[model samples]
Target: MTAMHRMTLAELVGGLSAGDFSSSELTRHFLDRIAAHDAQLNSFITVTEEAAMAAARKADEARAAGNAGPLAGIPLAQKDIFNTKGVRTSCGSRMLDNYIAPYDARVIEGFNDAGAVMLGKTNMDEFAMGSSNETSWYGAVKNPWDTERVPGGSSGGSAAAVAARLAPAATGTDTGGSIRQPAALCGITGLKPTYGRVSRWGMIAFASSLDQAGPMAPSAEDCALLLQAMAGFDERDSTCMNEPVDDYSAGLTQPIDGLKIGLPKEYFTEGLDSAVEARVREALKHYESLGAELVEITLPNSHLSAPAYYVVAPAECSSNLSRFDGVRFGHRCDNPKDLEDMYCRSRGEGFGDEVKRRILVGAYALSAGYYDAYYLKAQQIRRLISNDFAEAFKQVDVIMGPTTPTPAFRLGEKADDPISMYLSDIYTIAVNLAGLPGMSVPVGTVDDLPVGLHIVGNYWSEARLLNIAHRLQMDTDWHKQIPEAFA
Candidate 1:
């Protein structure tokens, strides 16, 4: 890897501050890397070269004028789910392939306000629907470590780009492990903040209740920096919490002595790969060595998470996506016989298979006669899952587990099996249900694939989680390990 590519986000910030390289030079280095290698990984759908150069020059000028912020001059990729004015925010589907956002998502505005340069829009699952990135119309995002294997999705492209050093950091949204699962599989760090801790305005909705945008980066410290800028209340989103934001980077080095770590019994049962289990256990032992107490806990309703998520998420997705009917500005059919024909043909032609499947399932669950039996029941079950986390947290400060049941699986391995694919987010969905903050920290490798030590904290406990993760990272080099091919 080139010197610029090898530098972590934290190091880059210091380099920029010290005038080691101009922002234009730094942006060019990363843009060059993306141009050289992204064709192989298919990580980005758009690379704003001219815009990036212009922004970098402005950042350089701002720094020279002593008006630089922590993130100024930093270049990061954005998940296409967020709207960027004048840029096509496709959300990895052809339905909005030509749609140019007229305004920026709150997250995009935050980054721009911090003077961070936008590298490009990264790819994702179509409308953020699939567990693997294969559902993206741009094609699958290959895991940088093993190109034949899949990078976990729907934030696969963001994870891959960061993992391969294409960008120091990127934005990602997690609705049932899109951020953490991909970060775990890609050997990077990803944080899913408490629901409403970050604004959802202008972010393309998949499951409104479950989707929350956060950061993906090479290390917890880097994520801390990114999340600092991304997390805050916005009046534009009614669901956003009106709480004060924490200085995540400030607490990264805090001691974890006397910290309580809960290990949920339900997360360690059958179907978990043996290698992944071993690595997770090893990390738990390491935590014990660091003077943290580990207490066995129970989230008994964990098994119900995947099933409940499928019901509730799709139900919300069906409703949120209904606005995309051809009558408005998305993809539309030509030469329609009538309004009904236009609506039918336009939707049928625009949506991908996964998107269609979820929409149908959702519509069925929310249908008149079946509403109580499916959608209502799933919401009740969601309450049970949330209750389970509440009970567990009553006795522990944070919960720890394997982020996913396995390491990155090969591309197409579970493509034909939708049920199997859904199980990939089993360990992660409960956190979203509970509206709590969770993160993935690289702990070790399983059969050459990375494994993450999943950490879930109570609501609004992002600072504590970041500190815990940062402490662990200081003692291990797993987070610093780079893919050999990229290195």
Candidate 2:
């Protein structure tokens, strides 16, 4: 109990079961930590003290009745993009400053039914648009490891909150690298499940086809427990897959021997930081020692990922974000010349710069004459990117690489250069483009910044990915490598 801050989800559940601590006590500890550190971290946009306490009380009642589940009473933070009933779900944008969802997201309902306590909503890039969380309307989230550096975005706040242990685990959406890159920078474990694996009905859309929600927790095993509660097909979401929920935790003991993991030559090429490559290679070496085999694979069109992603993601975003034109909820302008002025001034003042840039880019991509040259071409390339993953999967059980090209950079490092910021997600964007599952786990640290080892799995391969990560975690101390201050 003395090391409660570092305890994993399994450990916490077991401790709670044995009467070592009450759910309320555990929740208080996290809440206290948030209050103490969140000012500097800026991880949460809102903290639901009343709801969390009510849920904790109910969880204690369930435990007294001997009907508590493993996930019962666990306090979880959610990315602000998720619409939590009565909570301000801003998606880190000012446009939705007044928007209060009347209903919970499908994932939120799942967690609620499972008896998980809602801690609050974490910050993210505005509408999940930026790679570096600098685009958030609230403000940038600082990396827990290095306060001067960023926590990675659009899911930066989720990762930072988990890394700082403000909450045990949280939910995050990945459009490109939001979850994985932030998890990489924050030194926690994050997973973007296969597209359609989770319902997206109430999540604020970034890029409809590419955005997928997943878990960000202390480790992959925790992700399994969370995903167990947070995942399932929902009739409300057309894209949600109508499939049986697999026993993800049951596969934690599966053997990873003879697993063929592809290491894309493109990922290790120039522009990848030497320190990150070193640590990833070392992790891959450990995998090799476990009897897993590695092969150099070629994804010839990997370089086109950013351009293709920008084009396709923006086109989807422009259409999705049009709902925030001051009439339907959200923020309104102070004065309006007319209907057109109301829309223009509202959007012009409410949305941040990066958001406007994306809207313009996306609108142009989908515009009349240029649609064929940009949006259509991007869609075609997206198919090819997905095809690349499918082809690689035929010969490999999974793919491996560095989550981010480098550890979290200084907060303002890429703030001025959008292209450079986009490049930060180079390693992670393909998974979204291909609609494949991907994860980021801390494998090592470089210059005090934690290095994330990226794991890519084929369709519906989440359990397998977790198993591989668990084995590696058993043999390595990477997960134990917390930032010096937090430790």
Candidate 3:
């Protein structure tokens, strides 16, 4: 039998249903794994052992009564960005370090209703600001592959937890490549569903228009299972679409024989690491061998994505974060001279440097005089980038590219250089700007570190994207490889 800790989410589900192992035993196996290995990875921010055990026991009882839900008894990790009722819902910042959520986010509610057990809250970048997990207030999460290297951000902790098998799968939110970037670095499967596909009522807002919750796991099948539970429309989140949720797992085995893959010339340009590009191209070749056609496409405004995102995201962030002032929830300053001082000191003391930088940039961009030149111009550029994808989709079923320019880098390597760190998400941000679904799957390794092949699909095409990724996994073993230390 496969070791409980090493099994994928789907396998665990089957094990539970077949009575191969009790949910309590499975939960304990993962909790033990987290205790034994997480010291080196810093993947988890909180461990809800008591709550998890109770849930697992209840799941076992429900199954005994023949009333088990689809994902009954499965243990999963939730990114701290999601508000879990009675749990510390810190978005990896001191400001909300003491804030306990009074209600669960829509995503959390979905998982709970599906009979999933929460292992704990995973760490993340402070307010989901930085590309590298270094911006996390709790400390940077280490890659399971190499302890000295980063596990990408702001969903780094979730990616590391799954890669290390601390949890079978974990929830992640991608505002601008947060899920996919870390998944690529950690060698796992991650999906950034179309904006509003998954409700964001309680997920901490970074860029309201771009933030999305998705799944991160070992295989596309596991992601399919998780996404089935996560996707739906909620009236609470106005931005959430009323579109019907598809059976994400049902289409995993669908044939993608005549699939048209778009190879963006812009993605193959300078600044891309040679080895990373090689792996992506090799993956493209594998798809070609599978009878999928590759076509050349262009996203001319892609070069402007970074610049535009910098303006638009921060502007939205500035507005969203304003509610964190001292008088309300989150960190409050002690010994304030006045109301103004309290507000200033609480925010200044609570926010990390990266968060502060973005807030300043956002405030400046949206300020009276600069609004037209910066914010508005960025919006226009964003529309052009979106239109680029709209036009390209007319010729292609999915867009293929490198998820990141390079594999994981040393932890402190880019900490001092924000610009370089921000560029880590260069290949991923445009998808968010265009409100499309994107995912990353492990194709191969470069220098013992994993590289991911990025797949972008038109809006609401998550089912096809999952099918394409699952087909590749069926024909390859990259997604099955685990880090040596963890293995």
lDDT by residue (1-487, candidate 2, tens digit) is 4667788887888888888888999898898989989998899999999889888999999999999976888899999999999988898989988888888999898898888899999988889988778898999888889889999989999999999888989999999989999999988999999999999999998899999999999888889999898778889888999877888889887778899999999999899999899999999999999999999898888898999999999899999999898997998999798999999999998999999999999999888899999999999999889888888888899999999998888888888899999999999998899999999999988987899999999988888999999889888877755566665
The Cα RMSD of model 3 versus the native structure comes to 0.7
Counted clashes in each candidate structure: 0, 0, 0
Root-mean-square deviation per candidate = 1.0, 1.0, 0.7
Over the stretch 309-346, how does candidate 3's per-residue lDDT look in tens digits? 99999999999999999886999999999999999999
TM-score-best of 2 and 3? 3
Once superposed on the true structure, which residue ranges of model 1 sit more than 4 Å away at CA? Answer: none
Best by TM-score: 3
Question: Number of clashes in model 2?
Answer: 0
In model 2, the runs with Cα more than 4 Å from the true position are none
Q: 1-487, model 1: which lDDT tens digit per residue?
A: 3398899899999999998998999999999999899988999999999999999999999999999877999999999999999999999998999889999999999999998999999999999998889999889999998999999999999999999999989999999999999999999999999999999999999999999999999999999999998999899998999998999988889888888899999898898888899988898888889889999999988899999999999999999998888886779988999989998899898899999999999999999999999999999999999999889989999999999999999999999999999999989998998789999988889878999889999999999999999988898889888898777
Alpha-carbon local distance difference test for all models: 0.93, 0.90, 0.94
Candidate 3 global CA lDDT score: 0.94
TM-score of 2: 0.98
- How many Å off is the CA of 336 in candidate 1? 1.8
Model 3: per-residue Cα lDDT at residue 374: 98
